[model samples]
Target: MITQEKYRTTVKELLANGTIKMAIGYRPGSTPDRRRPLFIRTSEEADQLVLDSTCITNLSGYLVTEGLLSDEKQVGIFLRPEGIRSINILAAEYQLNVDQIVIFGFDSTGREVRPLQGRNAGDFSALLTEIKENPPLTSKEPLLERVEKMNAKERFDFWQEEFSRCIKCYACRQACPMCYCRRCIVDSNQPQWINTSSHTLGNFEWNVVRAFHLSGRCVQCGNCDRACPVNIPLRLINQRMAKEVVDGFDHFAGLSPTQEPVLASFKKDDTETFIL
Candidate 1:
C-alpha cells in the first residue's frame, strides 16, 4: 500500500508544485471498465489521481502531441514495466530527449504495497534487493520455452489464426506509447500501404508492419494486447520480437535512458540471409 501510495502522492506533489507542466496518469473514466488519461496541472487536479488494476492506458501515449511541451520544461512520468519499455524506445529513437523526463517506478504487491524492513532502506535499496533476489516476472525466460514447445509451422499458423480475428480498430496502435507517427503508413494517401478495409490481407499487413517496426524496440508491456477490442493476443508479437532481438543481436532491455534505440541503427556486420 505504501509503494502505490508513494507513487500517487509524489505525483500529486510534483503537480502541486508546478514543477511539471503536466502530470499524466489514469483515473476511473466514464465507465467501470474504462479509464481515461488524467492530466493534472494543479494540486486539486493531482489529488484526483488514483492507482489500481484499472490503470492500463500508457501515459506515454500522450507525450507525442503537437506543441505538447516547451523544450525548456521537463516532464515527469509514472511508469509501469511496459511504460518504461516505451521510454526505452523513445529514448533510442531520439524522438524525445531523455534528460527532460523523470521516471517514477513502482512494483505492485499483487494489489497493494508491501512494507520493506520497516521502511529500513530507502525505496531504491529496497527495490534493488528485491530485484536482485527475485527476477522480474516480465523476463523473456518463459517465452522462449513456449516458442520451442511449438513447431515453426504451428507458430506461424497460430498467429495467422489469432490475428485473423482482428477488427483493425487500430486500438493496438493507439495504446502504444511508442507509435507516435503523425501520419501512419496505413493512412497515407500517396500510396496505400494497406487497404483501409478490414480484409485479412490488410490486417496481416498492418500487424506485420507494426511488428517489424517494433522489432528490437518493443518493450513487451502488453498494452496493445489489452487495448485490442477484439481481444487479440498482441503480446505474442512483442514476445516474438523481444526473442528475435535477443537471439539476433544479443541485446536485451534498454536500461540506460541515454542509449540509442538499437533497431533503428545497423552495424556493418549485421546478418542478411534474406537480402540477396
Candidate 2:
C-alpha cells in the first residue's frame, strides 16, 4: 500500500510539472485479482492507479500504439523487469525512443510489491545480466522436460495433437510485444507464405515460423502463452528456441538497447555443424 501511494504521488508530480505527457499504469478490473491498463494524463487519474502482483501485463506494447509518442514528449509507465526488457527490444528494433520513456519499475515476490532502482532501461543492466545468468526455474519446467524426453516421432505426434486445437485466431501474435509487424506473414497473400486456414498443417507452420523469428529475441514474458485460447504451450517452444541461441551463439535477448541481434549478425568462425 505504501509503495503504491509513493508511485501515485510521483506520477502526479510528474504530470503536474509537465515532466511527462502521460503515464501508463494499472487500475482495478471487473474482479479484485484482475488489472486493466490505465492511462493517466492528469493528477486525478493517478489516484486510480494500482500496482501489485496482478499487474503482470506487459504494458510496453501500448507504447507502440499509433501517435502515442509522435509528439516526441516524454511518457511515464509502470514496468516490471520483463516490461523493461520489452521496451529495450522495442528501442533496439527502432520502434520507440528509450529517451522518451520514464520507467516506473517494480517487481513482486508472491504478493509483496517492491520498487526496482531504475528509471531508465540502461540503469537496469546489472539486473538483466543477473537474470540471464540465473534464469527462473520455470525454464526447465516439467512439461518442457516431458517434451524434451520424447523421440523425434513422439515429439511430432505430441505437437500435432496440440496444434490440432488451433483456430487461427492470432491472439498469441497480438499479445506478443515483439510481434509488432504491421502485416504479419500469415496475413500476406502476395505469395501465400503460410496457409490462412486453421488446419493442423497450417497451425504447425504458423507456430514454427513464429518460434524461429523469436529464437534469439524472446524475453520469455509468457504473454503469447497466456493469450492462446487453446492453451498451446507457446512458452515452451520459445524457451527451447531461446536455449538454442544461448547454446549456439551465447546470445541473451534484450541485454542492451544497442546489442546486435544474434541471428542477423555473422562471423567467419560461426559453427556449421548443423549444415548436414
Candidate 1: which pairs clash? 1-113, 92-261
Tell me the TM-score of each prediction against the true structure: 0.80, 0.97
For candidate 1, the 10 contiguous residues with the lowest summed lDDT are 114-123
Measured by TM-score, how close is model 2 to the native structure?
Answer: 0.97
Total clashes for model 2: 0
**With candidate 2 superimposed using the best TM-score fit, by how many Å does residue 216's alpha carbon deviate from the native?**
1.1
Q: Which candidate is the best by lDDT?
A: 2
The positional error of residue 273 in candidate 1, measured at the CA in angstroms, is 6.3
Q: Each candidate: how many clashes? A: 2, 0
Shift of residue 172 alpha carbon in model 2, Å: 0.6
Worst 10 residues of 2 by lDDT: 135-144
**lDDT of residue 170 for candidate 2:** 92
Model 1, runs deviating above 4 Å: 4-9, 30-34, 114-156, 271-276
The segments of candidate 2 whose C-alpha lies over 4 angstroms from its true place after superposition are: none
lDDT of 1 at 261: 59
